[model samples]
Target chain A: MKYTIFPGCLISYRFPEYEKSAKLILQKLEVEFIPVDSFSCCGSQVLESIDDEKMVLLNARNLAIAQELDIGSIITLCGSCTHILKKSLIKLHDNKILKRINKKLRLIGLKFFPKKKIEIIHIAEFLNKKEIFQKFQNLVVKKLEINIAVQNPCMVLRPSSISNLELKDRKIIRNLLTSTGITASSYRYMNRCCGGTMLAFDDSIAKDLGKLRYKELQKSGANILAVGCPNCQLMYSIYQNMLVDDVVPSIFFTQLLGLSIGFSQKDMEIDKNINTEIISNILNNSIKNNG
Target chain B: MNECKECGACTNACPLNEYDENYIVYKIFFGPEKDFKLWTRCCSCFLCEENCPYGLNPREEIFKIRRNSDRSNIPPRIIKYYENIKRTGFVFNIDEYVNEERIEYGLVKLNLDRIKSEVNKLFNI
Candidate 1:
């Protein structure tokens, strides 16, 4: 399948490491991915709330880029990006909406042919595909000793109509973690929101949710947290550090899998994550033992 | 006129409801607006739909309400984010330091100049 990177805004601004490691892992897995430039934001929930037509316009531009380049799917790192882009992909399938959006796209010299199909897939779900996982499994060179509580991006699975996930499919992230031979602990409220999106409008309530989630994660005895979305990354890594005294550090699943695939800590950009100095020490010790 | 058992499974499963007992948003969402008790709180996690026994989607119903509600109900901060998107085609400002960071991380620099004008045209409508 020909796939391209969506490069949603959050990853570019807050967490380039996710993009870096994801590219590196995809390279190692022998999956060919194209890098498309001049792509705009997915017009995430914030955009949908304000103007549905404009939201579809921006995403339609990006989708049209894929169609023009003959790319089959656009892989994304953020859950919100996956949701927004896929929502538009489905919306553009309607003949009336496609005509309306195309009127604007023509000005930019772009067009979206809904008949020529394209898909939006999140990185976690992408890696869990059986063939990709088999290739990824062969790359494992380290099983760093640690207990991790995985937070599946809620948007990637819910509102089932858009995400189109079945019960087995929702288990993608957790299953990918366990495959690496690390300890996967079950945390209460693991399936809930990280309150990152809510952090935009309601900081007080966001902290309330974060405090509750961290308590469940800490109580579960997990030493670290792995997430698929940057919203969750920024929340758990940055806000959790500031808001809570006891913190179970967070990393992208790409980073965790990068470690098992024999990429170094620096390769994963672990230092960018605050409150992860303890995690750094664990990796250092694991490396020394292996050495 | 609505099909709700008021099973409270969604409310019980809603983490937001854990802190605020009166925020039975699922109940409000499943019923008519006249039947709604002035709803509050939606983090948009959609667990309410996930937990519903009869496969009803209370979350979408709640979003339908928000999308059509008065502009006054939307927080000013959310409006600011909306403004940012219209201005730059991005949620946050991606300035020089950000581009430098992308280079250091070995990713391509974004050239939104063309895309921004295109977005401006779309927004002008």
Candidate 2:
């Protein structure tokens, strides 16, 4: 159970906690990770609108690196990165226009052999298996009893072969949470976008859209908003307080899971989180309740 | 000819109304002039298209808005990114950010001269 890890740019800098917690949890589950040292940024939203050719070439280059290392599965922490890489891989494998672009790679001393079946699994997908969930259950030093509202960013579960199996994805996460004695619920707008696409291009619209979703989650009375993607986490955390006048805040699923497993708040870098005191209180209550 | 149902279902189903209420679907078929700006705000999620009873594709109307928006008024940031992509066949600052770690990890470092020759031969660029 080894995978080539693609942390993307946001995870490496803005949200290193996700990278740290993910590595620790996966290792605990006996999943070996080989980080591709020379990996480039997986040109996410920008590539699709800008250069479809270079997007294919760059992504294929990453996949080639994994193939070179004989690692068939690639795991990503960003939903946007997962979506972009998965889409590009599918296109490279299925589209003729992309074949011509691969020929260009040959000139750069890179062979574009697309036969590799590189499965780009999200961290959630990697942790969704029953074996991993059972291992996670065994390792839980504290069981969080608080209600968490799960936010599934659209890019993560859409536009790929996995979209057809989205129902299974929802169940997997719920089952994992339930095994740990935590209560998780699917909120309305659970399968919506987090406005990542419009963030850079139209900041106001992006914020409004994010605020709209946050308001809905707040109305549901969930103590915390559990997120899988770093981009979505950042967006929600940035606007969480502003969106809800007086309500609980959001936290990454990794942060919550790490806390439940007896990882210190400092070790998980929880203090650096942008969300409010309500989340901190929730984490404190989880520790006390489980104790 | 079907009478005006006035059900407002098309207007009610629009996601754009969250941002702009004046963007009515009937505008496309009945208004004096198309308000192209209303269409630009659409995310193409297709909620309106699904809800329309007359089989009107609001998503297509958005495409028309994207195509008809004044070229001079195009956002400079988007235009610049698009142009850079056209020139290099990549959108990101790949050449500027290529580091030793990336090279050692097996990323194919692009040879500018070789890539230029290949693009020229392939697409007659």
Best-matching candidate per lDDT: 1
Accuracy of chain B in candidate 2 (TM-score): 0.58
A-chain TM-score, model 2: 0.90
In candidate 1, list every pair of residues with a backbone clash: none
* Candidate 2 lDDT over residue span A138-252, tens digit each: 8887788789777765566654343444545655445555567788766765665566556545667767777677777877778877777776776677665565575456666
The C-alpha stretches of model 1 lying farther than 4 A from their native spots are A289-291, B32-40
Residue A291 error, candidate 1, Å: 5.0
Model 2 CA deviation exceeding 4 Å by range: A160-164, A242-244, B1-74, B79-125
C-alpha positional error of residue A61 in candidate 2 after TM-score superposition, expressed in Å: 1.7
lDDT of 1 by residue, A1-291 (tens): 787778888888888999999988987887777877678788777877667778888999889988998999788999889988988888898999999999989988999998897888998888987888898888898887777898888899887878878877877887887888877899876678787887776777878888888888889898889899998987798889888888999989899899999898889999888756888986777678766
Q: What is the iRMS for every candidate structure?
A: 1.6, 6.3
Each prediction's DockQ?
A: 0.64, 0.13
